[model samples]
Target: MAPSATAVPATAVPATGTLLRLATAGSVDDGKSTLVGRLLHDTKSVLSDQLAAVERVSRERGLTAADLALLTDGLRAEREQGITIDVAYRYFATARRSFVLADCPGHVQYTRNTVTGSSTADVVVLLVDARKGVLEQTRRHLAVTALLRVPHVVVAVNKIDLVDFSQEVFERVNAEVQQVARELGVEEATAIPVSALDGDNVAERSTRTSWYAGPTLLELLEEIPPSDDPAHEAFRMPVQLVIRPQGAARDEAHRDYRGYAGQVASGVVRLGDEVVVLPSGTRSTVTGIDLGERSLDEAFAPQSVTLRLADEVDISRGDVIAAAADAPVPTQDLEAVVCWLGDAPLRPGQRYLLKHGSRTVQTAVRTINGSLDLDDLHAVPSEALSLNDIGLVSLRLASPVPVEDYATSRRGGSFLLIDAHDGRTVAAGMVGATLPTAADAPTTPEGDEAWDI
Candidate 1:
């Protein structure tokens, strides 16, 4: 297969600048699709053919004007129902910056889809209707965004035109949004009034609201710096494959070549840098870095490159290689906050497969601490977590695995629990504060007995 234009050499960095991954989230009918469409249209990212297609669809549906929301609502079911049901990813670029937008669903039923889309986003764009103010769904989105640790957030108060572009309405909504952000510990949030349907204050400053003065959403996005700190944190690479060219024709350099291949989960690794393989506590030095047919002097987080080691230490999938000083401690027990995704409630003693980065291992829920009450923002003691419920739980792994705190390192802290029988993801988990040993805490009858599944 031929490489696409977007594909670049492993060592090549764009001379112009960096790329940003952003996600759009909001409640149902909050104008998420329209906001995305307006941004693309006002930025001149949409082509004539696309515009014509939208117009044709609008006409067929007997709409008065071209429905810009059709641009992001790609699914036929979504178009027919006038609701976004799934996550739609769109890409567009300007001279100053490039963007990958994940348009997440706003419906409460699709929370899992939202989590999946925003998991890797650097910034989250949350849309709130100007007239409706902050709703339950708005708070839910904010909570999820904070939980995911998205570095930046932009709250676009959409449909300002319907509100007569009133400064008072905008101010009221903005104030409420600010209050919510403060409560959620989101320090970096920008609020802007926008008329998505009219394309105001999205890609360009709006003339309708002359009293307001703020950078356009596009302007703000282009100005924010891309996060590359993970590349410098600490070297971590989860081995995915062991590569060896085995053939009678292979000779010399090819015959001696043995590489551990996977994308760097975090930090920088250079040739000759000493590293340790986790779980086994094996140590080795990086002899070389290989990308396709070319050799590289170094590789950083997120870049997929094969590594040549100085020693022939046993390594395989599910094993992590990292800088010795920064290597995470291996453990069989873990505490975490899990968002249950399965139809069945999560019960203690129920075994599942845990997938962290490229590693997968058998795991079981040792205890269910409590479930979080979204409306009250508090934990309620519970024995099991039901579908769509978020709760704190403890897990015991069949084998030791290296992991870090979720707050400290997202790459190492986040994991997915999947059903071993069907390979379906059942929950999204974030490593929580570790619990003390039984001896550290005074024993009680309730705590002493094992939970019944």
Candidate 2:
């Protein structure tokens, strides 16, 4: 039998069978946007009018060829400035895999935007210009990716066409990147040579790089496994609202209705499961689960459902409900790495709103440990964290709140610090291990005074 054009390879699986969430990082004008545009175009994800519009714009700008970068640089400011200022999300699919790509800005000032986009990503794609080799921005991006602990990393050596498709240049760049990856404990880094402007080795294999024997970028993305961590964690549901409808039909069927509504953050929750609500530590058994009008026997991670308890227990927003045996303990003091996003520096003793999961509470910076020096990937002791700076700090919450270590659980360990005055998000934080008390520590400071929250 002969193979058909639409026939799937023996190794190929359905694209919808798995979904991959990835983020792209690079220096400005390093072809991050162009690479994304090339991927989408080659995959036939762009509409005819969209392609025509891009071509027309390319002509208006007096370019000899279409500007593929315009596909994702959608903001008017981004277009005018020719630099990405905000995180832009693009979706596309191949026969073998579906993807949600977060195209992050490359400007150093937009580091906060990069963090926001890559926080939930399972994999990160770091693009480097073949001509420039590895620059300072490239190293900084790698440092951020390592700090975030993205499970997978791919280093794409872009603009191979401009380098005349030299294999030696590609090998040199790959070796340098590998060294950085090794230092960061990223063991599974893959480097591929490609030309995003010319559509080589992006979606389809490039014939120009005959010396390279690696999978194309798209092929690699499809073959990489999806993250199963969220499904394996203990069930967690942060109550977003209480479902209650009152009207003439609110008699009989609706009269005895009381349910906690929220989206499942992780794991599986089934009917009759014993759960504990944090802060209050109230215990209850799941009597029923409702998804809109239909009742479900079980609900898993990422599902939105309303749960009814066997006994009426006090539950409200900002409370996290989880399996009693696996519930996290609430704590008042939290140690974390924060990415300061505000123009003003983050000062110790400043009050802010700490938002985690569905819970939001008044919190203050107890101490500033240090800020990251991206160029050298070292922690420099600092009294305050500035805009676009990453730092370690201690947070003192007004009350205890459930939080898991970031190393153990990303979803439970992450939070956002919002300025109380204007309600603007000031920093992104990841909970770290708690510091030992004086009695539990090997040493104690002299003339120690209790720190103020």
Candidate 3:
């Protein structure tokens, strides 16, 4: 399959199967690194030199077999500590499909890393030690996946070989995983038993598990749909830079050139499409879309393009250019779901810098409605939220921002909470805007006190 017609031809994109992004997440020591290494080794993605180094290192460590974890544990600190501290990315592919894998840390302290890795992942390969069916960390990871709305989840019951490859054990563990995944709004969850160390049922089917009838891990990877198609959705592009080349030496044809350069965040934009430069509400028609030296009739999400407008409009970085018919409303007040990443609890009236797309503004936590309990995926009325806590929050912005619901527009509806003082990322937010209805969020009365913000 050629690149989508709406996509820019100047870029080299996959043609057969759309690129898939996945992340490995599990409790510490759940063999996530090993599982990832097995996938690479079995698929012949690992180079001979790398495999030899792994072998030499394993022998030096007095291990009879190679330690595949060496392939992913890159940092010296991670290797010494035997825990992944940073998110490691790896690229590999089978003839059927291409993949970008994110090996996220499993510790509770690194929950933020998981968030960063899975934020853009198409599928989250959540590993579970067959011996330890579902840990608290598993619940937390599942909650994060739900909060982020990750498209697909594969529960790999790793280390099945350690349990004699028992079908009963696998079934018991699989049941628990499916129940939790479903409760957390994951529509489809697939659980498979595998031994990452032995390469059983990872890239290929394991003959030992005769009772199990399912697609191998590699087969599943090749099977899932890439994700939401940005080309078919509503058009949106947050201007990064306003280009004006007329000031410098230029060709006669480009002397009066002025354009807005930005990556298309969502949807498709075509020449002659009516667009509104947001916050300023300047309306104009798209005159041209250029990618380097090539002129394209249309462009879609994830592609960088310089757009020319028919009218001279006041536009700058942080301004959103959107389809006029589907323009978003700018508001000073925003209701959101926040995953607090800071060590300090998120308290009401606390000030921070809110970054939405390329726009940044002074903002404060006006109120914290409640926090979600990962154990049961329920809401707990709370005055403040601590690290790794998911909560409902309302924010007051110094300036109004044009935003949409996360379900409606993933790119426009997401934001980052940056600490004003030292520039640390405090939280990740998804715009809810409106309070949840009864059907969506069941009302549970707090003890003797009804607090309404």
Clashes of each: 0, 0, 0
Top candidate on lDDT is 3
Q: Write the per-residue lDDT of candidate 2 for residues 124-158, one digit (tens) a residue.
A: 99999998977777877786777677889999999
lDDT of 3 by residue, 53-146 (tens): 8889889999988888888899999888877889989877777888889999999988889999998999999999999899989888887887
**Candidate 1, position 277, lDDT:** 95
Instruction: Write model 1 residue lDDT over 45-73, tens digit each, in one string.
Output: 66667777887898998886778899899
> What TM-score does each of the candidates earn?
0.90, 0.91, 0.91
For candidate 2, report its TM-score: 0.91
* Better model by TM-score: candidate 1 vs candidate 3: 3
Q: Sort by lDDT, best first.
A: 3, 2, 1
Give Cα distance to truth, residue 355, candidate 2, Å.
Answer: 0.2
